[model samples]
Target: MSFARNFIGLGGLLSLAAQAQGAYTIQDTYDATNFFDGFEFFNYPDPTLGFVQYVDAVTANATGLAGYANDGIYLGVDYETQNPAAGRASVRLVSKQSYTRGLIITDIAHMPAPVCGSWPAFWTVGPNWPHSGEIDIIEGVNLQDSTSVTLHTASGCSFSQDSWSPQDCGTPGDGSQGCGASTDNTQTFGAGFNEIGGGVYALQWTSDALRVFFFPRGSVPADIDAGNPDPSTWGNPTASFSGGNCDIDSNFANHQIIFDTTFCGVWAGRVFGDDPTCAAKATSCEEYVGNNPADFQDVYWLVNYVKVFGEDGGFKRSIAKPFNA
Candidate 1:
């Protein structure tokens, strides 16, 4: 059902799976020239839409997305004095409609989780938050090496993770209402998140479950290319999201993927200097600052591409290759 074409061990491999029902193809590929068009805005500071600013920072597009080095879109944030909340920023896509059932796939070059006050995430939220469940597919805190996937709901919702690594923790509300942590190698998720090519993240949502999966650079199949994709064959959805947990499926309509690098504040900031664990490091949260101010204008996130696929009735989503080919 799939094949690979090796070109001097340099070019990426390609894999194709025979369609179980209808034809499948690539729906959209966010390249450098067109990547900015799909996103409404980047790195703008506004709390209403969840944007935070710092004094020192740097952000730019990396080349991995464009198949060239340092040429794709990237957003980096570095703060020296710490802000209200981690110097956070976010953007929205599909503002009018909520996509309850679809496949959201992206080639992310990096989602940094490097410092004590660093909180990096790729997640989705409904029109209004809290009431409409929030699905955090990839998230991590300071010193966390593995990514944490959690859902925030009002009630009548429970989650179970069937991952290769031992899953841990469960609390409720705003992530502080007794939430727990999963026992996975947090660094495995961050170690090479940006350096060794980056990783591919896929979030599949259906009436029955919300699933997530991560594919490392060399491990991804060739057929999952921007030119063509077959969701059924990209490996199981990373996480199986369920609907029995408070109509979360309905709450996540018209959601968007967000990439943010927030600094010490509220959640992560509180842990600094006060938390015994942090004090033991002999490095106060302030020690992380290395001449760079809160808004240094040097940090950023590089995204390869973001692709969305609307399910066509069954367990499959068919994407047609654009004629631009």
Candidate 2:
């Protein structure tokens, strides 16, 4: 279950209506004060082969690609000039500390607009990738209007759902399309999300299962803002993956929180022509994403905060650097 997708986005809403898991204490918060320091800028090539340039921390902050706006962390991309070399300039952040199981709550003010040639996500991944595991808390490609929560893992790692589940966690078709479900609520992503001033996306990962929930701005649970989160009161999750046939412990290890906006790649680019809007813009996805630079002016992330709540701070991933150099 990698980055690729069919892009249909709409699926049945199978809910379990389980109870609130439990209360959680905040262990870490990433807001303007410590956002940059808490995460490392991925200055490497796009692993998905997207049309993007992952810049370093110095360049991102100094060049205005990453900064703070109204006390919110702002991560944006270049929107000037046409078709530059090395793809569009963007930012990808990986949390310095990783966790095994925890409740992550992200309060977003705005996400990238629902525009063609853009793929954005707020997710988590184990250090070793496929063999480890990946949970897509919020993700979509092209002009998708809502969120798609999915799980990707190595072979023989599959999970069950309340109603009916997708296939195993391994790749089903040509590539990995990890079993997942969509929120189908327009207010949960893209333009609609920004119009309502964005809200909260919470990911609850426990040994028994992984669940994702979305609360629109005015509808966020009171407990969340009060520093106490009770998932049981949040109603059915937008997407839930049961640990039935999967080995949650062995398949998922210390995972780092991630947020990024990438263009035409394995997912978006592969199905470029499949999307009428994007296809009509240009013959290829790269051409439009590269030449129509102004089209991406609104491609950005406005985060109020990201709080991780867990006992023992969840499973901490050991690393040499306490902070990103």
Candidate 3:
């Protein structure tokens, strides 16, 4: 049930129709001044049980873990103290609003560098875990130089590979493994991403499919710069998840955007034995993260802005909801 035969290039006429209909409209804008207003800190225990202490807004700002910096919102982690009682202090933010479908654009100036024992992500998830769905937009663990874009759902969803990479979003053997694709662009993730001053990541989610595109700093589309982004002109996406095997509308709904940096969690810790460079630093991922605070100095996120646009003026303002953090 590969989607290769059904795949539609982003630059094709279908996208042109979306633009011609002027279906997209600015729905929300999150930036330094208003970012905190629209997002809440999650201080609860990590769902993945990462070795991290999710701090509150007060603790985050007081400890310099989260604040405004370089004309953008800065979310960072503790890198000075070693072996904290609970774990290394960090910040995890979730958007107050939830949406079913839209265009999400995030302009980032910097991301956590590809350091050992760190797992950072910019993602969205619906309620009830895999039953609803999860989209990993920008994610990597422990020294990964490229991003892994993935989708986690209950079952049935499958995808085909684009021309850029080999990893395909085929149906998972077990629902827990999910489906994913990897990017080969050196500057699309990790230390190289920060070295080039970061860039924009655009995610377009619709009933038909979920597509993600990445543009380095110098190559960002002019429409994006002018605040009139049109996916029709964006060409092929870095990754696309779609086909007859899945019902996107049924698997995903009311998703909230999120950003966080955790230390030695399931993904990073489980894979530590495979990376020689990291293995030499400590016997285990948790041990290294607990002992080597200095190594995580670059664990932070500098976000320029996050804009959400909805189709046909269907966007709605979300009411504040209590979240465990």
Candidate 4:
């Protein structure tokens, strides 16, 4: 991959943090030499211990699926729980903080998306109910052509269709549980995102609004190119998940990052089965994997890395390893 250099001033940094950061320059590249000397996977204060479980029985006992270069963790899904025709694969992560400024960028390098029944997602959630909040930056089920983004906040936070996209996107209520409940049409997000090498879904947050951006592999912004936290250069972007409309930011403080692969259960399983159009093509969850068993060999997400970046003016930025020095 070729590299480039970009400049990010204070305004550009704040804009990119709220919108899309600048293109990734070579300086942001992730080198194996500088792994996790200073970084720590966030462990949220919420009661839940964040982890990725497999639908297959055998692998689930192994804890996290696999690690690429020992950087980010992998998550697998079982055959029995997977409904391929439904086009839903399960993945979830919970933040460690109650309410601090943070960003999660996942390098989803090698993953299985070409097959059927692959539903992958990158998102966040709060401690309590809808009052806390849930942000789904990339979510799609059952043969979807594009990806979808949503925010689930109580009455406090909501979203608005900025000048970027003319669509009348509504800020979902707490009951819908944000994107978890909002059944958005999958085909609208474009074909590139659902394809191979997948893409990067960034969930940027603060006490204000939560925004999301999806970057295909080669096109990941320059600010994140070096693979550390630098939310200064990304440019103005059309796709975003703002929490300002509904008061969504207050419920979450210390957020944890979760990466898991789940099979058919509630969303991808039951919901697709009920859809009139997709039901005809949907087969029994059993027929999908035979006994690959959630206990054994299942689907997994091979992540390149999981990075955390702070917002424009909220928290202090700390670096574990200096790529340039």
Residue 133 in model 2: lDDT: 83
Better of 1 and 3 by TM-score: 3
TM-score of 2: 0.88
> What tens-digit string does per-residue lDDT give for candidate 1 at 192-303?
5655667778877777667777787777767666345566777655456442333545444545555555555455555666656656654645344332344333234566
TM-score of 3: 0.88
Q: Candidate 2: misplaced stretches above 4 Å?
A: 1-22, 172-175, 312-325
Model 1: ten consecutive residues of lowest lDDT: 1-10
Model 3, 70-126: lDDT tens digits are 667788899998888788899999987887878999999999988888999999887
Give the distance in Å from residue 254's predicted Cα in candidate 4 to where it truly belongs: 3.0
Which residues of candidate 3, in runs, are more than 4 Å off?
A: 1-21, 160-175, 313-317
Q: Write the per-residue lDDT of candidate 4 for residues 1-325, one digit (tens) a residue.
A: 1112121110111111323333321112221222222222322221221112322222332333322233334444433534344323233333322234566666664343423334555555454545555555656554455555655555554455342222212333434534322324332232443344555666666555555655666777765665444544555433554433444436554433444444444455545565454455446433443333443242445556555555445643322221110
Cα lDDT of model 2 by residue, 1-325, tens digit = 0111111211222221223335565667788667776777887888889999988877877677787776677888888958978999999988877777878899998888867789899988875567778888888888888888878888777766662255877776322687777666998888899888889999888888788888999999998988779887889888888846788888888788899999989898998899898888899988998878888888888888898877443434343233221
Give candidate 1's TM-score. 0.66
* C-alpha TM-scores of all predictions: 0.66, 0.88, 0.88, 0.59
Q: Which stretches of candidate 1 lie over 4 Å from their true place?
A: 1-28, 42-69, 78-98, 160-188, 243-245, 273-299, 313-325
Ranking by lDDT: 3, 2, 1, 4
